[model samples]
Target: MGDGATTTEAGPESAGVGAGLTRAHWWILLAAALGWMFDAMDQRLFILARSPAIRDLAAGADPSALPALAGWATALFIAGWATGGLVFGLIGDRYGRVRTMALTILMYSVFTGLSGLARSWPEFAAYRFLCGMGIGGEYAAGVALVAEAMPARFRPIALGMVQAASSIGAMLGSALSLLVGPQSRVGGWEGWRILFFFGVIPSVLLVLLRFRVPEPDRWLRARDEARRDPKPGRELGDVRAIFADPVLRRRSLIGMTLGMVGQIGLWSIGLYTPELVRDVVFREHRRELAVEADSLDDLARAWATETGGDADSKLSEWKAEADRHVGRGTLLQDVGSLLGAPFCTWIAIRFGRRKAFATAYAMSMASVWLVFGGMSRGVDALWMLPLLGFCTCGIFGVIVVYLPELYPTRLRTTGMGFCYNMARYLTAAAPVLLGRLAAGAGGYSRAAIIMSFIYVLGLAVVPFAHETRGEPLPD
Candidate 1:
């Protein structure tokens, strides 16, 4: 192994971080972090865009059926995400993380822009799935690059901060949605479509990644050795190798379980929060809108009966007003995310990774139920969403830092990608189930609470987790 790829060794984190990093080190961190930030922005944009885009694309469809339709689209997106994570991770391991990351940015940008032109639900879902490919690939490559590039003394800090930067990206997404709201438009384009178009702008960042960033010295060395001895191809993202080794296989199972809990909870829950808030606000605006109301058609009817106005125009106005508050709720979640990620990182640094995972999962489980069960007011979300965000998102800091520590340089991205994305195949079903449950007496809130139970599995898996604190990266 090269100096860049030291085997796990016990050591204390040093205060020499400022002295340890050079100009290039900072550049690597910033570049990887910003790419991840923009990726987060794309995720948030989809959350905000899903309902409106589905409404437009699924024209003449029953309003009550839109949630299930959107759920299916989201399922496709996660499916794409998992596939891309697996494939691009191999590419990163065999080729170069820098190039793979840059290529992913280009892929997502083009696809997301194309999503804006989707005229039907299937077209929109297809575009989102393709866009998810780019979005999903960026994580393993970015984390692997940063983990390899940084020295052990500051690797955790760098990884945690990189994960932390994503909250800022989420905030930017929320702010953009706030500015655009529901009724705004550009050249007759819906605000949701315009938001998808903004996905192209981040492709410019590819220049920095492509021109300035270099392959980690660790990966370069690994590639040289793999070329010399091509047998046992585990050195190049072989899926079987992760399963062939008993220790690695066990670690992979634990890691995959932990990753799935977060994936299922976050994707299913975040999908509906803004809409949940919109419903709450709309109901508050009109007393006649019942708690059991399952669709916007109820609001349309209420406006027509009570306000004696054009139902279509009134529905639009209500959505616009409620959307403003929804943006705030989303922003608060990001704010909590900003703080929680670092907090969990600090816990991992102090305690063990298992304990950190335990804390995050328990809190996440509680908050998920809180948000979905009787969290009916936007004002309540001011506090609830942040609590939810802190619990649900904080574990990412541990995830970003710890997964790379589990595998050697050659298999780092590949292992992390598999652990994180493979479980997404199971998670793809969660939204569909939630959608079905949502159409029942319990509605979105009840279904989301049911889905949140997946977090309990996170807690269950923690006992088997390997503690990686103060350990150097594996060779």
Candidate 2:
């Protein structure tokens, strides 16, 4: 192994007790978490609101075209997200992390709110894509801020906590859609407009960020060192510095692979659970509906009378039930986060980072297989849905904790941006794939089984990564 020396000189005060994180650390964590929470909330709201808005805009047009529009919008958003990660990751590395964080939050927030004003699908898609660029930048900046601020011993826990906070944001988004979505009167495209407006709430945090967060001391030191040295600034050499060594290269690769699989599985399995349930419900409803049909109106009237509810009421009731299902899934996901995050932190502290990752991956694989595979049939299978969420959430919660540990401070944001955002692009294809599989197989259970199998691939790669538990943050 290369002798890992501090890349920059530390102040005399920096040497003692590593100056165990003070109130400032907690304040930084709070600011980062809030920003991330809103970041996630806005992204998820777009997903939730998009379909309805597209359907409304396409009214008097072919219904089949809506899915295509959604796909196009999603593609545009992902492209923006990837671009943001690449551009802002460099910016964070070159500029101050605090400044970059502020810029990123403002960029995403303004566009996210602007998405509210979109009158057509093209306008909405454009706004969302712009908003995505901002959203994508937040992860790198926020992760860097929290990673740099916390004491090394507490970094894993801090990152885990921040990662878990996103779940809370996602759950809140779901709750808002359930609560405020139905009450909105903007029949065509207005429902989504209101939801987009709700995304503006996080922009308010920008004002507070100016007062609360500071530039990371590590970053400041690096800049000072760069200024003092004869080396030219804006050197392309720093880019190669990340991969010049074997250990760093290995860690970066491992981080990238883990991120790719984890992201694909998270979106494919986690976010799509509701769609899976809906497919099942629809199939069951269709079978029941097929039993009798006179005229379509007669069939509708008779079915409504027999069901003892109007279509809207029945839909509302189904929606309430779906909310309960999603609620359970969300709760389980949170519980997993609560358990796995601390556990991974503690394990990484005592055992090692690699072992901790392996253990988590093992549990994640088993949990996913059991929940998705085991639930392939029978009434008891329904219970597995929430259980799956619990297990996978724990797996995901381990990411923020572990990834930062793998890279030195200088390359941390770049490594993280590459791992996280690249995976997002790769995983973006999953929803379409899962939809195709569900369509071909005539059910979602098969699609879930396929998804669970991919987790095993992730498990196999765990052993290849270098162990970092109890190791000080690499220089």
Worst 10 residues of 2 by lDDT: 1-10
Compute the lDDT of residue 414 as modeled in candidate 1. Answer: 88
User: Which 10 successive residues of model 1 have the least lDDT summed?
Assistant: 1-10
Which portions of model 1 miss their true places by more than 4 Å? 1-10, 286-294
**CA lDDT, every prediction?**
0.82, 0.65
Give the top-scoring candidate (TM-score): 1
Clashing pairs in 2: 353-469
Give the winner by lDDT: 1
Model 2 lDDT tens row, 1-475: 0211112223321134234656667778898888888887886677666656666665665543544555566666766776677678778877867777788888888888888787777887788778888877888888887877677656666777787677677767766766655224455546567778888788777777777667777766666666677364223215465667777677777777887776666666655554454344444444667745322234446668777768665655554554445444444444444455566655655666666666666666676666555442223334665455556655556677777767766667777777777777776676667656765664556776677667777878888876655456654
